[model samples]
Target chain A: MQLKRWLNNYVRIWGVYDMAYDESEGEGVWIYCEQEKGEIHPVSYELLNKGRELADDLNTHLTALFLTPDGSDAQELVYRGADRIYLLEHDNFNYPNEIPFRENIVKLVEDNKPEILLIGATHFGRSLAPRVAGALETGLTADCTGLKIEKGDFVQIRPAFTGNILAHISTDRCPKMSTVRYKEFDESERDTGREGEIIDIEPLEYDGPDVKILNEMIIEDINIQEAEIVVSGGKGLKDSQDFEIIEELCSTLGGTVGSSRPLVDEGWISRNHQVGYSGNRVKPNLYIACGISGAPQHLAGMKESKIIVAINTDPSAPIFDYADYGIIGDLYEVVPKLIKELREG
Target chain B: MANFSIIVPIKEVPDIEKVNFDREKGRIDRSSATSEPNPFDLNALEEAVKIKEEIGGNITVISMGPPQAEDTLRDAIARGGDKAILLTDKGFAGSDTWATSYTLATAIKKLGHYDLIICGEKTVDGDTGQVGPEIAEVLDIPHVSYVNKTIERGKDSIIVQTEVWGRLYKKELKFPGLITVTKDLNEPRLPTLTNKLKAKSAEIERWGLDDLLDTGDEKHFGIKGSPTSVVNIEVPKEKGRKSKIFEGKDAAKKMVEQLRKDLGGI
Candidate 1:
């Protein structure tokens, strides 16, 4: 991939303030963009959209770093709001192995010390960011719901206390860091015509042989994220038997099934089925909730689901606030009737 | 084929959740409560011990809190850590994520060589999930958070399996990596009596403001070095409402069918 340069002199505004302060005290913001098989994930773009504002507010140039295999699509990183792209490409990096990727990131960060680093809370970003932060001996915030700049520092804000509270944090010793969850903010349009500088570096290699993955099984069936129809239940179901009914309904509708935190906590469902702030964010064309009371934490996870339908005896349930269709009656009676009607219809 | 170094960050905070808050009094009644290692950090400790066993290496747990946090250090050593470091100073209080990250980065630098640092994705108290990444930033290292499995650790790199949306991803990163593991990473082991005995006299190192900065790095330490502050704190209101319980088997059956229909079948 060819590296491009933006040469935006506007960043010089912050440079002048730095001279007025202490030349030794300089900081910049970095965004960790994840790429796989020469493809930049959309989550990285979303993060760039968020990081751009933070960097601009902190008065620092936004740099995007992409780690991928050698001869991969590294050039594609520059068009995504990055003032600079640090590319580390290698054959080993073709498939993301945590050790090699993280080591390469350590080298990249040490070479370029940014004041604040933002990463998308995607699978790759989540797994890699923490270990690198630890190796560097820095603190990191994860799954940030909001971000802002206060007093020229990147203010990383996220939900705390089981999504019950919000906490704000900033770094002082330079290079503060945080990871933002997907869909946490709207993705800004890419300035495709905007060219930026890209620096290709060799991936850091580690020496070890203690672990190995013999093989992996790829299931092409279930695509929970992109499922067109989703059936989600919560703690309101109360028992395992109730779950069976929910499952039957999902089967009839040809939809995947999901649960609230309580179901996972109760071991009634695997965490894969959890739908909430700490769980999966789904946007099915049709989302159905059974017996769910609509706790904010649960809603936070599934509020994005389109055509939400809530079935509960409680007419004033919070789930109704965001739901388009509400059945203010017993789920048991309404469900069977609806099912028969659907079958006949 | 042997590479290992683990760093653990500790936090000591009041058990605000279980605290009996007197709304009218606008305070918590701290009469009956105790503190424990943040659940995620405890999981980190367990993961560290497992890694140490798999690949011979020393495990060090570090914390930047009050002197009382020493209890946590001792507990960590008791569990399975090879060493414990506590950086406690009154000036450290009210420090935001940035300051905390700064202090931790400084402490680890003072401690020296490391290959991998493991920590909880987020702490119970702060829950920002920033300290770990911030530390990575301060030291300028690579990191991953919310990992599910280390698919492989090769002589040259480590491959990991992490969850994204509803799918699992197998990715690789080089060594000297920092990772924040989730509770789902592994089932953390409980402490054994042998390790508990070894921990009793495990000379915990205590570093103060002066100890951290022989070079005046102290100027940008603790809350003073932190940029963001907690402008306001509010307890999230419980989403409670009127409830109705359906009675009888017929009612239960009806509810089941309705739920089934809601799910898209009968």
Candidate 2:
């Protein structure tokens, strides 16, 4: 029995090797344009922008798979750099449903056969991308921060092992798919003169057991990712109430209030305000770290800021190493002083 | 109400907090790190145990890892898992999320019957959050990700609240479905002394790739079956700054001046 099993494995390995080397017949770079409430998510444009570069490198057209409700137009996607738009219109597309979206996407992917596919790493995309990849039996790299066409290979780069290591991955399968985090790449400038073909496709009718959204509550908090300046607090704060100081400083700077993971885990602040590898990645114009010791995970989210200022009583704090300017003083003293300075100035 | 059978897939990962990076070598020093059950998976197990306690059912915990992962499965059993199965084999090494989910879905198929499959939002090491949904897709069942609360459990369905893009959604999913839970679900509980003792001596069921071949193809079992491969790994180099340090009462003032000069006023 052992020998038979070994033989089976050997044969299967060889079979897989043969299949892996088969040249892909797929064409074009595709971006899954996610939409909500009749508006295209901004990340879709970002993907289109990046997809255009990849498609250009491969000398192919950039295609945007726009699934939206009836009456929505795909012209904006063309303006964003898409050479062709495959628009699927359905009333069900107005809200997010995993099964129908997955079914339709899987069918489209099977029929069109794009060489590369990129989707936003938003909550909706993360849930939908994997199911589509699973149905197609293709590999998908999640939350990719970088993408490149290296020597005709579609390379997907993402942080792994708690953001300490960056892994560059390549797929040996067709329709190489990746989910890129929003804000990781810049969106292309709108070009009204750009021309593209819009092909409206029929949506798949899914009658399977589906998830029904009973209630939807849109959160009304400041999106820290879009903030120009961010004032963040960390474990250095003696108490949760000290967040008030952070808030004061943030408001004085007309910025958003952010916190490290520990504060969010402690329930002292909402998860939306947390900034780190596991939280919202922010690239604000100015970032003030109050009492943050600067763990690698935290740095991964905000290190791209144009200016970083660290305030910690400990001069040896790791945040100081990354901060453009460091101040060695208690946040209680320095923060209040800064708030006063900003208010007076 | 009839009792429901719950299956929770957990993973053992390197202790993220204690993981050491050899910056010069551009690699992680795995030898210096201790392994622990992925924290998010613990939340999954806790939710499963809570569901079983409320509805009176069996909870089976499954994990795919090396032989050392048995310890993690034992830990799960101690925490409230009724039965633990470890999917360990040399052939399973180097499996990415696709192959891993396929193997797990195959093992789940061989488990006969289950009402629900619960998993952590994502593993700390990979942080992909793809396996749970991928497994559901392989099994052809409905799933919800980032579920934070269970509002109601009906005879044939479950109502859950999930968070997506800073929005809250209350969704109801039919039975025989899957759900990936977030950290906000519930606080995990410690094991009793009796349960801890029992789990220590418990005989964990071990299933190798051979055991799952009846339901899954051998080509889809490991690296050979994986569609994606890592071509290179790099440790991001830390960019140095001016590191101008200031102190005393006027420190804040001096820092403001420097920021104004460099940034053209804050």
Candidate 3:
């Protein structure tokens, strides 16, 4: 089959044809190299870094695939443990749109089949992966925090039951795909001594208008992913109206406002604002939570935040145990006073 | 407009979380592992049916799981797919994402004439959201995941809204494409009584590796083909202690003082 030949060619490119033919477990794995603003996401590096270990264990060549539009250069290609980098570039891919992004990825798979594929479980990864899996008629696990090779198979480990349990899912089919959460693994230390083959391919052409990128509303606000200061609230704020206090304090302190699952449940904010295992994982310089009881599920989301500040009326609130700064007071009274003083200064 | 052939990849997952685990033994004694249509996959099926209504095409529901997964395919048929395929075989067990995607891709190619593929954003069990994109990687197609809304569908491209870097991108995507929908896409319809009966009697095609992957490379077909594996299972240590329940004004006063110290005097 053309795919088999293509795989062989790829193997030869890596100078690891023997490994690909003999040791590559299952089919092979496709690693989606995540990038933002033309720069690869750190998590992408981490994935490749970890993927290499996985590929080697399974005797497979770790392959990297980049999906970007025209005007970009594939100069950053590296083996980083990858056997090959499938470079796909097109003007349509310059900006990330689910349709075109996924379309191009699917095209690569159709052309060269890999047994497994790894994607970072970032916002883009979470948004783009499922569609591609659907297209391939396969299974996918999301936000996998761990991965490894077991008995010649890849075991995709992910948090399940609202972070209450860890589920290990495996498919009997080739190319078992899963996304790894950011910060789950360390990025491979850059070792220039290592090198791999890079393959540049023509972008897949489909007749219909590849989706138009109408607007790129860049939030000037520090991305929560990169923010050093975060002030989050929970359902205890009660209503949309109460969120003002949390927002005001955060604004005063020049920090971003985040929320626990309760806020999303209360419909006080969008899911983007949510913090927990189900939401964003943040590690900021200072994380202040007002009126959050710090449920295990909620703590699982933000425990990594460097310095935590907890304010609640309940002295026994779970949030206190994790807070570097614990306050026992009415958040209603405390937040406003804090906001006023910060403004005066 | 040409009739678009839509394929909805489905899954039947054990409600493993709901099953009580014997902590002493640390095993899922799934005497209670109830199977459900993966919540998101159900949403994918619903979206496929909705698209079928708007686009006028056959919606084929397909899944790769144990034979028991046939129940889910029948459920999809009842919900409104024109046909269904269940890719199952004893050899297809303990597959990782790589092998899973490869097998499914082979099956899809065998099904033939699929214009669009749709899937749920993520399954409840795995929650990794990798399989979809991995499949896209294997199929070599463009893919979009976590689609919030389908704004418009052009003859050649479909316009959709999805989040990128916390920002929503509304753009047109070409047809003969693939997309994964989130629960927010639409409300799923319950199966009709008559349709349920029809599905119950429907002959779901059960395809094995020989039928689906006759041309697939043996190296990439199943567990032996996967690369990554879990090193070990260590339960993350619980980070915080239970909140100490405080009572009344006295507790409130003590709390405020603690706050003053943390806030450096309120």
Per-model chain B TM-scores are 0.85, 0.95, 0.92
Cα lDDT tens digits for candidate 3, A214-312? 656665444676676788987568678888888888876667889987677667887667777556778876788888998866786788776677878
Q: Write down the RMSD of candidate 3 (Cα, Å).
A: 7.0
Question: Model 2, DockQ value?
Answer: 0.74
Angstrom error of the Cα, residue A85, model 3: value is 12
Per-residue lDDT of candidate 2, residues A1-345 (tens digit): 597568657856667332222336778899998887678889998899899999999999999988888535699999899999988888788777788888788778767778898999998899999998888788999999999999998999998876777899999888798999888899989999999999988888877548887889997877889898999999989898889999998888889999999999898998889999778889998999999999988987898898999988888888988888888888888899988776666
Please state the error at residue A141 of candidate 2 in Å: 0.6
Query: Highest TM-score among the candidates is held by which one?
Result: 2
By lDDT, who's the top model here? 2
Query: Which tens-of-lDDT digit does each residue in B1-266 have in candidate 1?
Result: 44467777867655644545554443446564477788788878887777777766789899888787888888899888888999888877767665677788888888878877887877765655667766775676666566677766543456776554334566565666677777677776777888788888789898888787853355457766554455544454544322233345444345445445555433
TM-score of each model, in listed order: 0.67, 0.94, 0.69
Error of 3 at A120 (Å): 5.2
DockQ preference between candidates 1 and 2, better one: 2
Ranking by TM-score: 2, 3, 1
Tens-place lDDT per residue, model 3, B230-260, is 4444445555533343344454344445444
iRMSD of prediction 3 = 5.7
